[model samples]
Target: MSDKRADSVAFVRETFIPEQPAPSTATGAVKWLQDNLFPTWANGLLTIVSLYVIYLIVTATTPWLVNGLWNTESLAACREVLDGATGACFSVLTERWNQLLFGFKYPPDQYWRPTLAFVLMFVALAPVLFFDLPRKLLIVTGLFPFVSYWLIWGGTIFTPVVALLGFVAGYFVYARFVKGSFAAGFFGGVAAAIVVWLIGGGFIPEGANDTALLQAVPSRDLGGFMLNMMLGITCVSLSVPLGIALALGRQSNLPLIKGMCVVFIEFIRGVPLITLLFVANVMLAYFFPPGSGVDLFLRVVIMITMFSAAYIAEVIRGGLAALPKGQYEAADSLGLDYPQAMRLIILPQALKISIPGIVNIAVGLFKDTTLVSIISLFDIIGMIRGPILASTDWNGVYWELFMFASVLFFVVCYGISQYSQWLERRLATDHR
Candidate 1:
């Protein structure tokens, strides 16, 4: 049997062939078009119709953009230049670009301050957003709020220093008691911060700001896209932690905590955000002690933060509620305390589930910053509606100005959307 098998003809190649490119019919551009565009008769028809529609849109709009009047001084100049041609007067944006970005009232000399803050924000956010970046960069992240506030507000060095000190004190207090009890650490940290702020308020010289390197810019003077970015970023950053706290509180066994969280969430959710903003603008002052002199900027920040936190909490709650009961039972079985269980296991999973909802709410909140215009605060829309459009030179140039605003907002919202998608892909462990 062995002799007969050995003698039988069986082909074996001596050299292994290198891999070659797939056939034209099976790969690359041709294959993709065949599969996606002409997979069936109906798909082919749809593809043709879609292409026709795209062509129609481009044909109708391309001349308006291509013939845009970009170098003119005003709408009048733009109209003269266009001379009946289908075109956009992008000149309004060019003429008043600084006012659109930094507001009309912001000192021209100090324009770099907010601009620097905006650029630095990307640096601070890099580690938080990408996570693969150096963890040490988070120190820059931690100091960013204080540094940015000083830069934009141009306040006494002592004021931001005191604020930073309060946070430092809070962190130290939290570190001291966190291992013993989370509640003790949390409440203790808050108390420590408040005490530091209260005490430090008296020591800073009032004149420290006058002779300071950068002159203070009053809150009333803040306007344009800068104000919108400030509100959106601050509220979003603040609300995430508050939202998480409210979500946990809602899930608490403690009757008092659960009841409080439920009441806050339900009441806030019941009211429209515009109503809250109105209160923050007009009515909140009545509730404060007489002559308290609270800044309008501070009030608006509080209201926006609370409004977003309520929505975010509900989003996070949905995430938490979707988890299987077995997860909770397993944490209990492992002798994990509530805080440990939530922080170490439950929250990471729940937050991942909530990412889409959270991003949606964030996009909404950023857009809603326009509502500040109704209250007489000049954000991007306010700048357009009030200053640029109402002005003699740029009056009637609505399309270009609004279109610019739209593009700016779209860029930010789309970036958030794309980042969320990237994050989802990164966190996917099922390899699906």
Candidate 2:
């Protein structure tokens, strides 16, 4: 009966079947293409249409790119060389590349200074962006602002040295007083820094720049892609911390603090960035002492920082609100104070949630740095419109010039986007 039952069971394997590779049609590139591009008849048709469109675009652009004149001195020369062939006058980019990077007024001899500063910026940012790096590298990050300022602006070393000292003094004061009251410490730190600056101002000799190793370059001379990068980086850095404070303040139990934060965020958000920029360019001067003549770059930084902070505050507030009640309760149960709770627990989670929004704001803020061109600052676009195109050599090379600018902006924006995605993945601790 057992033998008959075994025969009826029909070939139960005595040994386990060996694992085999998936079929070529069910794996690898072929499978992926089939699943993604041609899973359905409709998708296959759409893919074919898309390919045709791409092919057409490539055909249209290939000749222009292939025949582009890079060595010609002028658009006319480029056209003569092309002799009515479909081609691009890309020589403008090669010729005016310096002016497109650093404004025409920046002394060509001193170009190495800004170039060095630009390179050091990456080194300074590495530790801050990638936390797995040695924490000691943060010292470089701390000194970078002053060092880069000295390098790019090229003045008496005393200028940045004094600035650094002022910050050091402010930090000490903040550290000393923070154990007592946060507000007192904050205000005390500011007052100390101001005092340090005032004291340091007297020590810098009036003829310092004349004797300095690197000749001073005034802020007005800063332009092109360099100016945009500086403004975008500096403002984004300043705004993030300020935005966090504003977000926290808005949620404060103190009505005064909350109201002030609310008003600032709402008012700033209500006003257009260009309007604020106009205020920076034209109106802000009236508020400063008549002889003070604060740098336009500084004014623009302040306005942009404030504008970006408002949006970031709203984003962070949303992030904070997204947290479950248990998170806050857990902090309270741990016997933590408000500041301690925020620093240790609440903020990390909230900031992780807020990363995407903050990155969006940052990318937008970087692009908006081009708007400074409208106010007569010669950012890359300003260089293109004002100097490059206005010149006889490149008068008609609009497409090439603008395309170069677009490429520059796209590279920076894409990098920021990629980094943000990596950061999000890194911070995603929840098991899937």
Candidate 3:
């Protein structure tokens, strides 16, 4: 029986040939085209049809793009330059580039302040976005908010300094008490920050406002793409942490805490973003104490943050719900406390699961920033629909201005999408 089994065994080859390239007909771009684009008769036919459609589009658009008038002052000049040929009137973009970017009302001399902040935003975001970068660089990320606020708003440096001190005090208090109780520490930290801010307000000098600073720009002066950028960045940043807190609260054992979170989320989610924005624009002032002077930008931020936080909390809840019971059991088995287990084990996994949903919300929120134009804020859409199009020079040239806005938005939204994809790939640990 052993001899017969040995006789039935497959023979192993003693030596193998070195690797070789595929045949010319079955390799490179030619092979890829054959395999993917024209593997079958039907596929080949579809490929040909699609190629022809692309050709038609490119041909039809080519003349307009090729003959685009960039230097001319107005639509009339662009038409005169084009004469009888098809051409794009892009002169509006060139002439109002500063207004399209910095808002027509923004001080031209102080353009460098916002411009510098805009450039530095990417630097500030780098360490946070790409964690593989040096951890020490997070100091720059931490300081960016105060710095950005100082630059864009041109307030007395003392205001931001006071704000930073409040945060620093909060952190120290939270660290001291967090080991004992999360709720106690959190509320304590918040109270500490408020106390610091209130006290610090007393020390700031009245004369300190205009001195040692760039000219202060009102929130009303902020417009065009800059407003959109500001709103999107601030809201996205604020919503995530608030969302996490809400999600945790919703899942808590305490009835009061859970009920409060549930009610807040439900109320916010039930309301349309446009309604919230309208309130921010006109109605929210009535809710504040009499004689209070809340900036439109601050009101808008609060509304958008609340709106986004509710949705983000729901997304995070779904992530938490998707986790296996065993995950919680394993954390408990390790003898870790609730916060430690959540921070170390559960949330990392849940957040990974929730990333796509979170990013989708973020992108949608950014696009929704354009809706602020309905309230008379001159964002990119507002700028186009108001200042740019209303001008006699660009009155009838709709396509070029709208197309520029579309391209700018597409570039930003597309970049965000690409970053999310890269982040997903980076965090993937399944080995597949």
Clashes of each: 0, 0, 0
Candidate topping TM-score: 2
Candidate 2 runs further than 4 Å off: 1-24, 180-188, 429-432
Best by lDDT: 2
Give me the runs in candidate 1 sitting further than 4 Å from their true place: 1-26, 173-188, 429-432
Q: What is the TM-score of each candidate against the true structure?
A: 0.90, 0.93, 0.90
lDDT of 3 by residue, 75-154 (tens): 88988888889989888888999998989999999899888999999999999999989999999999999999999998
**What digit string (tens of lDDT, one per residue) describes model 2 on residues 30-63?**
9999999999999999999999999999999999
On the 0 to 100 scale, the lDDT of residue 296 in model 3 is: 94
By how many angstroms RMSD does model 2 differ from the true structure? 2.6
Error of 2 at 115 (Å): 1.0
C-alpha root-mean-square deviation, each candidate: 3.2, 2.6, 4.6
Q: Which is the better candidate, 1 or 2, if ranked by TM-score? A: 2
